[model samples]
Target: MTNILTRPGLKPARPFFSSGPCAKPPGWSADKLAVDSLGRSHRSKIGKQRLNYCIDLMRDALSLPDTHRIGIVPGSDTGAYEMAMWTMLGARPVTALAWESFGEGWVTDAVKQLRIDPVVMRADYGRLPDLGAVDWSHDVLFTWNGTTSGVRVPNGDWIAPDRAGLSFADATSAVFAYDLPWDRIDVATFSWQKVLGGEGAHGVLILGPRAVERLESYTPAWPLPKVFRLVSKGKLAEGVFLGETINTPSMLAVEDAIWSLEWARSLGQGGLIARSDANAAALDRIVEQRDWLGHLAPDPASRSRTSVCLTVAGADEALIKRMAALLEAEGAAYDIAGYRDAPPGLRIWCGATVDTGDIEALGPWLDWAYAQAKHAN
Candidate 1:
C-alpha cells in the first residue's frame, strides 16, 4: 500500500497517452495551422503541393530509398494496407503472422474477405510468431510493432533479403519512433495519427520496387474499392503517388502531418528515436522494480518502445479497470487502459512525441493509482 500523502507530487505535464491519436509535437497548437492553404480544392495547385510536401517530408525523414514510392491514401492505415493486400497478395502464396489484434485482423481479411489460402502463424499476446520457420517464398504479412500486445520484432534480421516474396508490414504504430528496415519491407503502411501525433483520416503507403512491380503486373480477383485501386490500365497510377488522392482529404490534417514531419526533421531521426528509447527506459526503471506489474512481453528484446503494454500480477480485470478509471478521473493519465482484447493492465504510449519527463512523471501516478484501487476494492 502507498500512503496518499507520500504519493509523488509530480504529474505529467502532458497526459495524452492514447495508443492512437497520440500526443502532439512538443509545442503544437491550432495556431501552427496559420500556413495551411485551407478552403482550397485538394486538387488545387496549393493543396496538391501541400499534400506532396507531406509525402516528401516523411520519405526524407524516414530515409526511404529513391526506389520506393510514397502515397497519401484515405481511411487511415487500414485503407492503405487493404489497397496493397488487394492488389499484390493473390499473385503469390501468402503468410499472415498474428500476435495481436491488428495482425489477427489481417489474417481474417486474408482468410475470409480475400478468401486467399493463407498460412496463418499466430502466437499468444506477449510472444512473437516464429520467424525462422516462415516460408520466405510466399508473400509475408505482419505488423512490425504489436500495439495491442506489446510485442515487436527487434529488427528486420528475420526477413530474407533475396527471397522471392514481398514483405508487407503494417507499421502504423512503429514508424518514426523506431528504426524500420525499409529495404526488407516491400509494402509498408502507417497513419499520421500514430507516432507522428497528427490528425487522422489519411494513411501513408510506401511501395518498394518489388511492391510497385506487383501493382503494375498483378490484378486482383475481386473488384477493388475506388480508393484501393493503386494501378490502372496495366500501369502504376502516376497521380496517386504524387498526391492526387482517391478522394477529398482534410487540409488541416495534411498541415498537421507536415508540421509533425518538420518537427521530426528538426530533431533528426536518431534524436526522435532516442526520445522514445528514453521514455521506455524511464518506464523500465519503475516496472522492473515492481513485482506487482510486469511487461506483457516477457522478453525484454521484443518489448515495444512505442506502446509499452503491461500486465499486473495477481490483479483481475475489474481491479485494472478501476485503477485506470481512477487515474483518468484524477487527471493523472488518459487512455492508459490496456487494449480491450488484451490482458487487462495498462498500455502507455512512449513514442517520440511523448516527453520522457512526462513518462517519468507517470511512474508515480501508476503507483498511486494502484494503491488507491487496491485499498478501495
Candidate 2:
C-alpha cells in the first residue's frame, strides 16, 4: 500500500485516524531505525539487551508490578492471546465473553482449536457482555476495550473477590488509554500499534502470579506449536517474556515501539491517558450538539476512550458513503468508515496521538460533508 500521507502537494485531508498502524509520531526520524541490528543475530548479546530494554521500559511506563513478567512475542496481539490460552487455559472450564470482533475470535479459538468447552457469553456490537451474568468460577477471558465497537467494560468490580479462576484480558487497544485494574486481570496482552502509535507485528504479554500458577500447574489439551509453546512438557518458559522472543522480530519495529513508549513516558502516563479521554470528550460534545449523529454505545459510561464509533441518524446509506468519501477526498480523514460487520457510520481513533483540537475540528467537517452528501444524494 502507498503511504497515504505522501501524495504530492496533497497533504493529509486531516490528521490520520485509522486504528492500527496509526500515523507515525511527528518527531520520529529514520535515523533511529538505521542502527546496525540488520546484520546481527537476534540471540546475540546486543539483541538481547535491546529486547530487555524494550520490555523494561514497557513495564515501567505501564506501571506493571515488579512481580509481573512481560513477554515480547512474534504475532501482534493475536499471537499473545493464543500463547496465553495454550499455556494457561486448562486449569478450569473457560468462560469467554465477547462483544466485538477480537473477542469473538478468542471464543472461536477456545471452542474449535483447543476443543475446550467454553461457556460463551455474547453481546452485539456497541454493547458489552453482561459481566454480572458471567460465572466467574471458570477461567475468564474478555477484552477490556472492544476496539471495533467502541465499547468497554466500565470497571473491574464485576470480577469476584478471591475468585478461584484466572482472568485473561485482550487489552490490545485499552492498555495505555485506560486505567487497567492489574489486580483483577491475571494475563494481559497488548500490541504497540494502538495507543502508542507504533508499527505493528509484535505482541506484549504481561503475566501475574495467578497466570504463572496456571502455567506451572496444568497442560493444554492439544499439542503446542513452537510459537505457542509456553509451558513445554512441564517447565515454564522464563526468558520468553524477558527478552527471548519465540521467533525473529522486526528490530526496526521494536525500535520504533521503544521510541513511542519513551515518548509516552516523557509525556507522563496519566497525562497521555487524560489526553485520550479529553479527545473522546471533544467527540462526545460533537455528538451531543448535532441531531444528525449519535454514539453507537448506548451507555455513556461504557463508551470507549480509544476508538470512538458514531452513527448518523436520518441519513441514508448513500449519504454515509458520500460523507466518508468527501472527507477522504479533501484529505480531511482516512479510515473513518465504520466496520463492514457493523451498522454503517463512522469509527474514529481517538487515542493519545490524536489531538483534541483535531477532534473538535471534525464536528464542523462532519456538518460540511453531511450537507454535501445530502445535496449529492
Candidate 3:
C-alpha cells in the first residue's frame, strides 16, 4: 500500500491516457508525418494516392477481406455509423443492442430519428445483454466494445453463421485491439483517433458485399443526405472506396493518419493486439493488488482491453473528480475520469499506443490521489 501523505517516487514518462484521441505511438513526432499532401486538394494525384494508401494500410492491418469495401467518410465513427444506419437499415426487421452511451445513441437514432421501431435490447453499464436471444432474422446493430463501460463481446461466435439480416459493428475502439471476425461482420465503422491515436474529424466506413447489395437494391424510406449517399444510379460508388471521398477531408489529418497507419503496419495486427493486451494486464495486476480498486466489468472474458473503466471503493462523483484533478495536477495522469454518463470512477486508455510501463506507474499515483481525496472529503 502507498502512503497517503507520501507521493510516488517514480512518474510515467508519458502520462497521456484519454479514451479518445488516445496516446500517440512510441517514437511518434509531428515532424515525421508526410506533409507533401498538406495544402493540396484531396482529389489531387498525390493526395488521392496517400488516401488510397491509408485505406490499403488499414485493410492490411485488420486483415479485412476483399469482400469488404473501405471508404474514408466525413465524420468520425459517429458519422460512419449513421451513414450505415440511414442507408442500409429499415430494409428488414431491426434489432439494436445497447449497453453503453454510444450504443444507446444508436438506439435513439433508430427509434426516434429513423423511426424504424427497432427491437431494442439494453443492459446496464458493465454488463452485456443476452447475445443468444438475438433474432438473426432482424438486422443487428451493436458495439464491438463498450468504450464507456469497458465491456465487450467475447467474440463473433454469437453472430449466426447463416443469417438473413446484416451485422453492423461500431468498432472504433476494438479494431486494432482485437482480431475481428471479418466474415461475420457485414458493416463496421471506426475513426483514426481511437487505437491509432491519429487526428480526428474523419471516419472509415467498411461495407461488406451484403451491405453494398442493400445499398443498390433497397432505397430507404427517408431521403439520404448528400454526404451519406453511397449509390449513384443504383450502382455502388466504386470511386468512394478508391480514395474518392464523399466530401472534402483535411489533408493534414489524412497525413497524420497515414503516419499512424504506417506505424501500425510496421507492427502488424497481432503486434497491436499484443500491446493492448499487455497494457490491460498491467492495469489488472495493479487492481488485483489494491483493495480499493476494481474493474467495472467483472467478467474477464468480456472485459475491454482498451478504454478500461474502474470502480473506486466508496467513491462518488465528487471524490472521483477530485482524484482525477489531483492526478492531473501532479502530471501523473490526464483525462482519466470515467465517462459522465457512467458511474463515477476512473477510465484509463490501455490501447496499443499506451505503454504498459505507464499503466504500471499509474497505480501508485491512483492510490495517492484516492487517499488525498478521501482525507479531503
Model 3 lDDT tens row, 1-377: 67889999999989999999889999999999888888889999998999899899989999999999999999899999999999999899999999999999999999899999999999999999999999999999999999999999999999998989999999999999999999899999999999999988999999999899999999999999999999999999999999999999998888888888888999999999999999999999999999999999999999999999999999999999999899999999999999999999899999999999999999999989999999999
Q: After superposition, how far is residue 22 of candidate 1 from its true place, in Å?
A: 0.4
RMSD of each: 1.1, 4.3, 0.7
Which stretches in model 3 have alpha-carbon errors above 4 Å?
none
Superior candidate under TM-score, 2 versus 3:
3
Report the error of model 2 at residue 288, Å: 1.3
How well is each residue in 45-81 modelled by candidate 1, as lDDT tens digits?
Answer: 9999998888899988898889998999998999888
Which ten residues in a row are the worst by lDDT in model 1? Answer: 1-10
lDDT of 2 by residue, 1-377 (tens): 12233333333434688888665655777786646665677788878888898898898788888878999987899999988998788778889998888899899999888878899999998898779987878999999998889999998999876888888989988988987888888999999999988888899889998888778788766777889877755767888977988899888888888888888888777988998999899999989998888999999899998888888876656677887898888777777877766777888898988877778777767777777777676
| Backbone collisions counted per model | 0, 5, 0
Error of 3 at 128 (Å): 0.5
Q: Which candidate order results from sorting by lDDT in descending order?
A: 3, 1, 2
Q: What's the lDDT for residue 102 in model 1?
A: 93
Task: List candidate 2 segments past 4 Å from native.
Answer: 1-14, 32-34, 315-318
TM-score for model 2?
0.93
The lDDT leader among the candidates is 3
Reference-based lDDT, residue 170, model 3: 98
**Which stretches of candidate 1 lie above 4 Å from their native place?**
4-7
